[model samples]
Target: MKIAVIGSKGLPPRQGGIEHYCAEVYPRMVAQGHQVDLFARSSWIHLPWYQSCRFHGVQVISLPCPGKRGLDGLISSSLGAIACLGKRYDIIHFHALGPSLFCWLPRMAASAKVVVSCHGLDWQREKWGNCSSCLIWLGEQVAIRCSDQIIVVSEALVDYFQDTYAVEAINIPNGPASYWQSDPTFSFVKLLGLEPQKYLLFLGRLVPEKCPDLLIQAFQRLTSTGWKLAIVGGQSDAPAYQMNLFKLAAANPNIIFAGELKERYLAEIVRGAGLFILPSNLEGLPLAMLEAMQEGIPVVASDIPPHRQLIGMNRGRLFHAGDLESCIQMIDWAIQHSKEMKKMAQKAQEHVQTWYGWDGITAATLRTYESLLCPPRSKVKPATELIQR
Candidate 1:
């Protein structure tokens, strides 16, 4: 099938869950003999507008972008939507709510089945201002109205759509990216003064929603000794928040801000970690946590729905969301009770490996596309019936 993808930074996934998600799923789709053309931002690809390249068999076309935080996605997605209008794509898949704003264009102008994957509720993110948040919200509404099928990354999102918009969305969770086993000598992390099982790791974008500041605050108040905090991520349009985090950790020499480690470096840090903590107030089935669990690293996350879904049932520990005391308690417990945390890590590793493989995720996505295009003739409810006015 010919597919057109929109709403990702670019291929090879420098940062962001949507980008990594595209890098994993679409390439696999290409390997399965599907033609996938991904529309990307020139800001990310650093290429001339309209220039195209191939990554692991998937064709990535760069579109003009201003490189601004919110405007970049808006302009790129608009152009991407217009570009799809001239093509004969079987499926035009949009990755996030911001880009799904233009999903209506392909639905109305092209002969394609539009699919919108709601990775998260972007409107609730603190980085986006009121105008940007409103635009994102409108995109969500537009996606509900225009798309042939909607895909959500977590059951929490499924419940969100049903309760808020009365819309039925398919739940398809994200899979972990392949991790390389780093050198046992621990050369890379040792450069940052991080020792194996002697530091806690927080891996994700340094954003307000992810609450790196909260982690820093909690880490400062911890009663533990000899253990350091290694915060690894890029500041995505949240430089001020990132700066604030740095300030919060300024007095504490134990906190190390190792900006954005990828591939082997990332693998080493994660593998060497004593614990992986994500105190996010919001999430769409965090891929970072998934990767940590897949590596058999114990986790301590906020009591958000997505985190609970991943870590509940003794898979990992959870603390009250946004509570400093709760976070401190969980971290201290996980550190002190090493044997119990190791057992939970084993269970989490097994759970993710068994349930969240990329091949299975790709296959499930393809099945969703096929069902939309060649739906069975058995007595089934129409797509319109799935949405309540």
Candidate 2:
């Protein structure tokens, strides 16, 4: 089948969960002889119109984003969709809600199937404001209502749409990277000046919703105990909040700030960590947490539904969100019970192997697409069963 994926973020996973989803899933589709096209926005230092090119097998189409981030993400993505109007394809899957404006393409071409995967409601996020905020919220409601099919990553999201917008969704957990261990000679550690077992990790965007400050506060509680905290993620552009995090970190010498790590170094740093934590107050099945768990390090994440839905009691540990005391308690528990944490890592690895590996995710995603296309004629694939390696 011919497939077109529209999202502001492009493939090769330059950054973020949506990119990671596109990078992992589309390739698998290609290997199975399906043609896929992805729309991405490229930032040019001087020139305009950074065009599309073939990588591996997927065609990545790029357009220049007019403004920075939130504006650029919503605007450029809509432009990309507008550019792809009248395009030939069987399926047009949108990775995020902002990009669902691309569904306008299907209205122009009858045979094209349009889908919007609500990765998360960015409108509810702290980044968006009162003006564009309302616009995005309105856009999201319309996008969810009109799309041919809606895919949600977490059960909570599925219920949210069903009640709020009366939209039924196909539930597919985000893919997790397979477990791989470096032979302890990876140059990533020495380059970052980090020592294994000496530091804790917080990996994800440093944003208000993510509660990076909570992690910093928790790390501060452990300063006298000689445990260092390494916070790695991209800038959320909240200058005031970022500075606040800095001030909090500065008061504690054991905490280190390693900003914005990309693919290889990211996986290496996470895979080598003694522990990985997420302090998100709200989440829709975070890709970072899954990536860490899939990498087989022990996890102590916020007690949000998405994380709970993924790990439950056996696979990992959780603490109450936004509670610095609980965060500190979980951290100390992880440190004191390092051996139990490793056992939890083993359980997490087993869970990942059984469910969330790339193969399972890709198959589930394809099945979702096929079911949407075929509907009444389609046979339901069992939840755990998918085409295997």
Candidate 3:
């Protein structure tokens, strides 16, 4: 199949989960003999016009994302969609809802099938600006309506789409990056220069939305002097928010804010950690937690829909979002009964193998595409009428 994959800042994921998702999935799609073309944004100021390059048989056409973010996604994907019309592609798979402006172009192309995989809706996220929120909501509405199929990362998101937009979405969680396979011979204690079996980890963006401050405060209140917290993620963008986190960290000697470790080192840290903490406000099946769970690290997460949907009630610990006391108590509980945490880690590893591993996710995604391309030939049959594989 000649597939045109639209939306993103080009293939080598220099940043963010969406880029990581494409980086993982695109190569697999290409390896399966699908001639995949990526429509991405080129940040090069030297380029005269759009440029094309090949990586693992996938053609990456890098165009400029207008105004760099919300505007860039909206425009670059639209331009890619316009160009795709003349390319005679079989499938137009757009990565995120932000690129919905292109749905119109694909909709007019009767020969092409449109599939939209919304990583998460921007408007639903609390981070969007007022103007961006309005624009995103409008775009997502068009995207959900025009696309032939919608793909989501979590059952919670699927429910959201079904209930709010009345759109049906096939659930497919994000897969792991290729680096997950190798053994880095990593030790969290050695890396942090701490005593063996002694530290808790909170990994992800250190922003207000991620609630790193809550984790910091929780660490401060915890009575366990033996256990310290390592806060790993990018620096917060909003200065005031960053200041707040730093101030909280200042009050607590046990909290260390290690900003954005390199990917390999970070993965090693995750594999070596005693526990993974996520106090995020919102998420669409966070890749960070999934990655941690894949490494068999027990998680202590925010009691939000996305986290609950992934971890379930028994798999790991859940504390109320932004509640410092609840988080502190949960941390204290984990520290005291280290054995239960280890058991939870084992459970998490098993759970990951069962449903959240990369290979399984990739296979399911392929099947979704297949189901869309090839429907049942006969008339509607009872759900039981379908033969079990």
Best by lDDT: 1
Candidate 3, residue 173: lDDT: 75
| RMSD score of candidate 2 (Å) | 2.7
Query: Which of the two candidates, 2 or 3, achieves a greater TM-score against the reference?
Result: 2
Q: Which tens-of-lDDT digit does each residue in 43-146 have in candidate 1?
A: 99998999999999999999999998788999999999999998899999999999999999998899999999999998999888899999999999999999
By descending TM-score, how would the candidates be arranged? 1, 2, 3
RMSD to the true structure for each prediction, in A, is 3.9, 2.7, 3.5
**Segments in model 3 whose C-alpha atoms lie over 4 Å from true places:** 44-48, 178-193, 377-389
What would the per-residue lDDT of candidate 3 be over residues 133-182, giving only the tens digit for each residue? 78777778878778888888877888998999777777777755544433
Off by over 4 Å in 2: 44-50, 102-105, 177-193, 382-389
Deviation (Å) of 386 in candidate 2: 4.5
lDDT of 2 by residue, 1-389 (tens): 88887774665666667877887788889999999888777762223475777756988877777657576677667766666566677787777776675566565554767778888877777866777667767668667656787888888888898898777787776776543455466577656677776678898777799998988877866633756778998877677888888987786666778898765667678877888888898788887777777778889888888888776867788899888998888889888898899999888877766777778778877877788788998764755565233
In angstroms, give how far residue 327 of model 3 lies from its true place.
Answer: 1.4
For all candidates, the clash counts are 0, 0, 1
Candidate no. 1 TM-score: 0.94
Rank candidates, lDDT, best first. 1, 2, 3
